[model samples]
Target: MTGGRSPRRAVAAADRTRQPTEVRRRLIVEAAVPLIAERGSSSVGVRDVAGAAGVSVGTVTYHFGSVQEILSEAMVLQIERYYAALSETADRATSAAGALRLLVDALFTEDTDRHWRMWFEYWNAGEHHLDPAFAGGQDRRYESWHRQIRALAERGVADGEFTCADLDGFTTRFAALADGLALQRLRQAPPLTTQDARRHLHRFIETELGPGPHGVGLGPAE
Candidate 1:
């Protein structure tokens, strides 16, 4: 006769033991993202995230130093996911102009509205609270966008698809235009709809690049 733990119990214990530390950290951050996005980082705490993740407070602190760190990491994770989606859209296009069109269209979708709301909260926190943890978050986000825009512009110029006179100036102007339009779109009274935003951006591209292959609007992807 033998006495041992049941097979199901043993398998359950093995599964628990196999969960990696990195996976646990990611789980915690994933749990925290919605909370921070919906309620703002200022309103979320370690206990809330721990409860959401079904992990103990000590586990959260073990992976992330403090509440501020968790919130900041959550913001970074959201932006990283956005970048991945943008990159995927760009990858599907055959030309730089097509890539730009796809990227702009992706920007105005309903799914990204939550991301914009979270980013707005981040900006507000950085501006009003003078919080050191959030100090450069907004700048970094803009910089990432700028880099992508600049790369796309350069590619277009190299391929002879675009006739931008000043690459740097054109990139900066387009980025600013998108940001301003995004803000307007996010307003409660939203002066511009997603279609309007796309039209405005496409028009600007046409004007800058002149009416050619690069200037042709493909319209939003289905």
Candidate 2:
């Protein structure tokens, strides 16, 4: 045999050389996301993420600084993706009432179940742990969600599709109701189905905003 490195060793070296810094960072973060969702942010370790990402622990630390940083970034990434989807849904609505209905549908669907689970995991982590990054990210998520819902409420009022004397109060109440219903659907035995949650939320919206133009109501028909 010639004086050359083995094939496997050469391939490994090439792989390492070909991987870009940003690619490596994203791999680690993406790997961490599912782990955090499955096991909660507080439960995952740096080595676990590195192993899952097929990188060394040093590589994870190099990119994210710490497990907490990786967890925080993963949470932020999920929320950003979710907001993008919500914005897309909002863009397709024919009216503000339709927008609100579509938003509720988007939130409680099977596609969002993992996201809701991860969210509650983060909420639990926030209660027991004291990481400022995680806490700050959670707060920003709450504020962003509230801001979007409030904007939708304002639009409905402006279009005279809804009648609310206190927009902010209505937004807060609506958001709280959504959160509570989602939690119940996630945590309860004989869990609340998406249809059940939608019906409850639509009833609440009707109570808060009244019927839309020509008694069309604020949500889709059952």
Output the number of the lDDT-best candidate.
2
Instruction: Give residue 129's lDDT in candidate 2 (0 to 100).
Output: 58
The alpha-carbon lDDT assigned to residue 45 of candidate 1 equals 79
The C-alpha TM-scores of every prediction are 0.78, 0.84
Query: After superposition, which runs of candidate 2 have C-alpha atoms over 4 Å from their true positions?
Result: 1-16, 128-134, 212-222
How many clashes would you count in candidate 1? 0
Model 1 score (lDDT): 0.74
The C-alpha RMSD in Å for every predicted model, in order, reads 8.2, 6.8
* TM-score, candidate number 1: 0.78
Clashing pairs in 2: none
lDDT string, candidate 1, 1-222, tens digits:
112321121123345456799977877788878877767788787877877777777888988877877777787888778878898998898888889888888887777777876777666666664565467767777788888888887777777676667878878899889878878888846577888888888877777764235444333334
Q: lDDT of candidate 2? A: 0.77
